[model samples]
Target chain A: MSTTQPHKKTSGAYRHGDLKKALLGAGLALARQGGPNAVLLREVTRQVGVVPNAAYRHYANQHDLLQAVRSAAMSALANAIESELAKLPSINDPADFARANLRAVGMGYLKFAQDEPGLFLTAFSVPDDLQGTAVPEKAGNSGLNPYQLLSVALDRLVDTGVLPNERRMGAEYLAWSAVHGLSMLFIDGPLRQLSPAQRQIVSQRLLDMVEKGLV
Target chain B: MSTTQPHKKTSGAYRHGDLKKALLGAGLALARQGGPNAVLLREVTRQVGVVPNAAYRHYANQHDLLQAVRSAAMSALANAIESELAKLPSINDPADFARANLRAVGMGYLKFAQDEPGLFLTAFSVPDDLQGTAVPEKAGNSGLNPYQLLSVALDRLVDTGVLPNERRMGAEYLAWSAVHGLSMLFIDGPLRQLSPAQRQIVSQRLLDMVEKGLV
Candidate 1:
C-alpha cells in the first residue's frame, strides 16, 4: 500500500497529511516482525520512502515512534479481547455471564500472544502502569483497552456477587498477573514449545486458578 | 582482580588457564549492569585484558559466554531462595511446614527480582525449558536449582496432603508462571515504580492466589 502512495510527490512537496498514517503503518509492520525494539524511526521512514528529517516531523525520536506502535499494539490486544467478548452466548445468570466474560478476556489474551508474539511483546513494551490509557486511540471498538476490559469483567463478578466486595479491589491486577504470566511463559519462557492442545489445557487451568482463587 | 593478575604473562603466553575465570568475572559484572544482552564476548575480553582469540578459548562466541552468565545468574537465584529457606522456624505440623515453605519460595523469588533485576533477567534469558538444568554449576548449596527448589516445595505439599496428588504433576509450571509474571511486572512492566511496602502487599496477595488456587 505504501509503495502505491509515497509520502512525497514528484514536486518534492509533502503528500498532504497521510504521512503520519503511513509512518504508523510502517511502525506496526516493524513491530509485527521484531517487536518494539524494531520500530526504529530510520527504518520506518526508509520503508515509507521518506527522509529521516521528514519522519522527525511526526516523531521527535525513536521512543516517540515506539510509543505510537505500542499504542496500536495495545489497541490490537483490546480488539482481540473484544472478539472473545463478542462470542458470548445469551445467558440468564449474571454470575455465569461474568465468569464467561472474564474467561473470554483471558482466552483472547493468550490467543493473541500465541498467534502474534511480537505484537504481544510490543503492547506491553512501554512501562505504562496497569491502569491502561483509555484514550480512543488505545481502545477497541468497545471503547475500552485491555486493562479496562479486564476491570469491567471483574466488576461484573462483584456486581453479580460472585466475588466479595472487599476482594473486588485490585482483583483485575491479580487476574491479569496470572493470565499475563501464563502468556509470558508461552511466548518467551519454557512453555514456548507447548503444543496448541497443551496450551489450551494449561490456559484453562490457569484461568480456573484465578477464578477460584479470586473468589 | 584481573588488574592485579593479568590473563597472560609478559611473554605473551597463557597464565595458568585462569583466563576462563577472569572472563566469567567480567561477564558477570557486565550482566549485573545490562542483563543478558550486555554479556558480549568482545566487551568481556576487553575487561579481562585479553584478546578476542584468547577469550574464544574459553567461550566459543557471545552465546557461549551468555549461557555461562545465565548459569551463574540462575545459581544466584537459587542461592537467594536458599537463604529464605534457611530462616524458617521449626514447625510440628507437616501441612503448615509445607505451606510456609511454598510461601518462602515465592517471597524469595520476588525479592530477588526486585533486588537484582539484571541478574534475574539474565537467569531466565536463555529461554531454557522449565525443567531447569540440574547441573552442579546451576544449582545452589542444597544441590537444587530454582526450578527444583520449587518442585520440592510442591512435593512437600502433596506428601503432606495439602495439595491433591493429581494436581501435583504440573503444579511447578503454574506456580512458576504466577511468580515469574509478577517479577517481570515489577522489573519491566508498570509495577517498576511501586514502593516497597506496596510491593510487599501485592506480592503477598499474589502468593495467596497461587497457594489458594493450587490447593
Candidate 2:
C-alpha cells in the first residue's frame, strides 16, 4: 500500500492544524488518479501518514471528506470557467458579448471535463440543490460558482434581448442539460473513445445546438 | 445473507441448461436494485442457490455478466422508445408525423429514465462504441437499438423536410445529448429532486429545444 505513496514527503506526522489540509491534498490526489470512488478516508489518511481516526477529527466520516473534496473540485471547475471568461476580447455589441459569455462557460466546462475527468466526476459525485445555493467555497476568484456563472451568462442574454424574458425562466436547465450531457458522453459514455479533434468538432456542434435552441 | 433472496424457489440445485438463464435472471434482478455495480458473481451465484464456480460456466467473469445485463437494459430502453412510437396517431401531414416521431423518441427515453433509474444507470454503465453497433441483443421489438431508434427519428425528419438533410448528419448526437443529459440530471445530479409535474414541463421544453435546434 505504501508503494504508491501520494507524494515524496517523508511519513512524518502532520503539524497541528495542517492535518486536514494534508488529508484533503491526499484525497485530491486520489481523486485525480481514479474518480470519486477512489477518495476513501482510509486511503487518504494513509497517504497523509496518519491513522484514520486523525481524519475523523477533521471530517466526521468518509462522506464528509468527500464533500470537502467535492467543494474543492467545484472551485477548480469555477476557476476553469473564469479562465475562459477572462480570455474574451472586448466586444462592442451586448448580444455578441452575451453569446460569447455563454460559449466561454460551455467551452470551459468541456475543457475541464476532458482535462480533469476524475476531479470533474468527483465534483458532482454528490447531489445538492444547486438552484440558488451560492456558497463561497465553490466560488472562483470572480466570486461566482459554475452554476451562478451560467445564470449570469443567460441573464446577460435576456438583458441583451438575445434570449426572450419569458424563455429565460428555466433556460439554465435547457442549456445545462445539453452541455453537461455532452460532457458526460465525452467523458464516460460511448463518446469516450472519440479523438480530441473529433471531440472538438462535436463540442462546437453541441454548443451550436444549445445556442440556436435556447433562443 | 439469504434474507433478500432473488426468488422464492428453495435452495435446490439447478437443471443442466437452466443455470445460465437462472443466473442471468438473478443478475438482472441485482441490476434493477442497484445498477451495474450490484451484479456481482458471488452474490448472483448465491442468489441462484449455486456455488461461485457455477457462475463461471455461464459467465467467464463478472464483466461478461454485466455485459449481458447491460444489453438487456439497452433492449428494455429500446422497447420503451418503441412503446412510445406505437402510441403515435397516423397523421396525414408528413412533417407533423416526422416531428411527432422525434418527440415520441425523446419522451419515451425520459419516461424510462424516470421510471427505471437503476436499470437506466446500469444500461449505460459500460462505455461501448455505440456508433453503428446494431447487435441483435440490444434491439427492441422494432429491431432497432436506442441509438438506431434515435437515428431513425432523425432520418424521418430529413425525409419529411422537417430537418435539413445537411444538419441530419449528426443530429442524433445533439438530440441524444439533450435527452440523455436531462435523464442523468434527473436521476443522479442536482435536479434529482424535481417534482414529476416540473419534470414533465422540463422534459417537453428540452424536447422542444432539441426539435428546434436540430432543424
Candidate 3:
C-alpha cells in the first residue's frame, strides 16, 4: 500500500508523508511480538524499511513513538468495547441501559485483554511522560479513551439515580480497579490457567461484584 | 555475611550453603534497581562475587532464581501487611476487628507499592510457574498470604450477617481486584501523579467502595 505510483514519482526526493502511521503500525507489530519492550526505534525503522533519520523526523525519540502506539492501542480498546456494546440487545429503561452498557464496557475490556494481551498491556502501560497525551477519550481524533467511556457509563449511573451523587465521586476508580485487576490476573497472573468457559463464569461473577460494589 | 571464617579456611573447595540466600538477595537488589529484567543470573553472580556454576547450583536458570526472588518478595510483602495489621488499635468485637484488619491489609499493600515500588512489582510479577508458589498469604511460615487475609475478612463479613452465603461465594476477588487495581494504578498507571494526601483520600474511598460493594 505504501508503493508510490509512477505519476507521483516525478520528484527526485523520496516522500513518505504517512511515515508516522507506518511507524506506529510497525511499533504495534513489534509490541505484539515482544510487548512494549520490543518497540525499539531502530528495529521499527528496519520494519518499515525507512532510514533511521526518516523515522526520527516522525518520532523525536522512542518514547514519542511508543506514545503514539499507546494512543492507537487505546483506540483499538475503545473499538473493542464498542463491539461489545453493539452485541447487546436494545434496552428500554435508562437505568437498565446504563447498567448493561457499563457491563459491556467491562466485558469488552476483559475480552480485549484476553484476546489481544499484548495490545492491552501496551495501551495501559503508556510511559510516564506520554500518558496524558495518549488518553483515548481525550484524543481529539478518537471518540473516547477507556477511562472516558468508563466515566460516561458511571455518569449514567448517577443520572439514573442508581448511585447517589455523593457516592458517584470517583466511582469509576472502584469499578475500573476491579476490572483491570481481573484482566491482569487473567492475562499475566495465576488466573491464566482458567479454561475459556471457567473464565467466562469468573468474568461475569467479577463484573457482577463490581456492579454491586459500585452501587 | 557469607564470608568464610579464617579458622575454617583449610578446605580448598568453596562450599557456601548460604549461596542460595545470597543469590536471592542479590536478585532482589537487582530487581530493586531495574525491576525483573535486571535479575539475570550472570549479573546476580557478579554482584555476589560468585561464578556462574556456583549460581547454577542453587538456580537452574534465571526463571528459577526469579521464582526465588518472587518468593522473597512475597515474604517481604506479607511482613509489610503484618506490620500494618500490628499497628491497628485493638478491637473487642470480631466483626469490627476484622473490618479494621482488612482495611489495614489494603493500606499495607498500597504503602508497600508506594514505598518499595520495585519490590512490589517483583512480588506481583512472579514468573508464571512461581505465582501460586509465592502467594503472599500461604508463605507457610509467614502466617497468611494476601489471599487468605482477604478470605478471612470476607468470612467476617459473612459471619457478621452483613453478606449472605450466596453473596459470599467469591467475595475475595471483588476486594482483591479493587485493591490490586489501585496499587497498579498508583505505581505504574496515571495515578502516580496523585499527591500523598490525595492518595490517602482515594485509598480510603476505594477501601470503602470494596467494603460496601462486597456486601
Candidate 4:
C-alpha cells in the first residue's frame, strides 16, 4: 500500500501550511482559464511557488491534482446554485417554489458553464467514482445540488398534488433533462442560434412546458 | 490573405492521393480509442506511415484535423440513425416513430461515447464554424438526418391533426432536449445509478410525455 503524506510546508516564501489546498486552488484557476489539459503539475507547482516534488507529497500525480480541481469545480457550482436559490422569495405554494428553484439552479449551472467553461468541463469529465466520492460536504449542504434540491422540490410537488407520486422520478428526470439539455446546447452544442432575447423567450417557453407537464 | 496550398504531399509516402481522408480516418480511429486528446498530429502521421509535416498538407493544424474527425463522427451518427429509422415499420406514426428514432439516436450516441469517448468528446468539442461548414450532404438531404427525420415525422403528425403546427419548434426542442440530456447523463454525468432496465424505463416515460404533450 502507498502511504500518503500531508502537504505541510516548512519553508520561507512557501510557508503556506496547506500545499494541497494551494495546489488545488492554483489548478482550479488554470482549469478555468485553459481547460483540464492546462492544469499541468509543473505549472501548478510553479503557480504555488513550490518544488515539483512537493506536489507529489499531496497529489499522487496530475490525475490526482485534476481530481481535486474537478471536486473544487463541483463544489463551486453547488455554492453558486445555493446562493441563487437563496435570493428568491420563499413562496408558500409548492409549484411556485419548485419553478423558482429549478430556474435558479438552471441559471446557476448555466452561469458556471459560461463563466468557467474549462472548470465546468473538468467537473463533468472526471470518472464517476471520483465525483461520487470527492464531492465536498459543502456541496452536499448547498441548495445548488441538483439531485438533493430537485428531489426535495419534487417530493414537495407530489405532496401538494401538483405531480403524482408514482411519476415523481419520471417528472424529475424530464424537468432535469429539458433544462440540462438546453443549458448544454446553449453553451456547447449546435443550438446556439438563438439571440439573447430569443433565448429568454425560448427558455421561458421551456419552463412553461415543465410546469404544464408536472401539473 | 494567407496563401493556402491545396493538398500537397510533403512526404513521398502519401503521393497525391486522398491524404485528407486518410488523416481523418486515422484521426477517428485514434479518437475512438483514446478521446480527442489522443488524436495528436504526430501520432496520426505515424499511423499513416508518413512524416509529421505531410499531415499539415492535408490539415492546417491539430484543430483542423479534429474538425475532420468530428465531421466523420457526426456523419457516422447520422448514418446510424437513418439505418435504424429505415428498419421501423410505422413511418406515418409520429409517436411511434419519435420513440424508436430518439432511442436509436440516443443509443447510437451513447454507444459512440462508450466505445470511443475521445472521438465522441471531440465530436462535440469542435467549433461551430467547422461543423457548420462541413455539413454532410446526408444532413442536407433532410430525410437521412435524425433531426430532419423527426421534423418530417412531426410535420406529418401536424398534417394529420395530431399535433399543433404552432408549437412545432417548442415540441421539437423539448423532445431533442430530453433525449439529448438523457444521453449526456448516461454518457458522462452522475446518472450511472440507473440500471440498463431503469434507463430504458426512464427513456420510455420521457418519450411518453413527449407524445402526450404533442398530441
Top TM-score prediction, candidate number: 2
Clashing pairs in 1: none
Listed for each candidate, the true contacts retained, as a fraction, are 0.29, 0.38, 0.41, 0.33
Candidate 1: tens digits of C-alpha lDDT, residues B21-138: 8888889988877776577788988887778778777777777787888888888899999999999998899999999999999999999998887788777653222233223247
TM-score of each: 0.85, 0.86, 0.82, 0.81
Give per-residue CA lDDT, model 4, range B151-176, as digits (tens): 66666566666668888788777776
Tens-digit lDDT track for model 4 on A30-114?
Answer: 8787767778899999998888889988989888888888878777777766776778897887777766777776666666665
lDDT of 3: 0.76
Q: Clashes in model 4: which pairs? A: B35-B118
Among these predictions, the greatest lDDT belongs to 2
Across residues A34-144, which tens digit of lDDT does each residue of candidate 1 receive?
Answer: 776577788998998878878778787777777888888888999999998899998899999999999999999999988887888877653222233223247877889
> What is the per-residue lDDT of model 3 for residues B1-215, given as tens digits with 9 covering 90 to 100?
55655334454437665888999899999877666656789988987776877877778888878878877777777778878878999889877887887899899888887777777777776343322442333352357876666677678777877777786755667777788888888877767788989999999999988887766
Off by over 4 Å in 4: A1-14, A126-144, B1-17, B91-119, B126-147
- Cand. 4 Cα-lDDT: 0.67
Per-prediction count of colliding residue pairs?
A: 0, 0, 8, 1
Q: Which lDDT values do the candidates have, in the order given?
A: 0.80, 0.81, 0.76, 0.67
> Over the true interface residues, superposed, what is the Cα RMSD of model 3?
4.4
Q: Write the per-residue lDDT of candidate 3 for residues A1-215, one digit (tens) a residue.
A: 66665234354336666878889999998876566767889999888777777877888888888878877877888888878878999889999999998999999999998888777777766353322342244331347777877788888889998878887756778888888988887777667788989888888998887778776
Worst ten-residue run, lDDT, model 4 chain B? B128-137
Error of 2 at A80 (Å): 1.1
Against the true structure, what is every candidate's RMSD?
4.9, 6.0, 4.8, 7.0
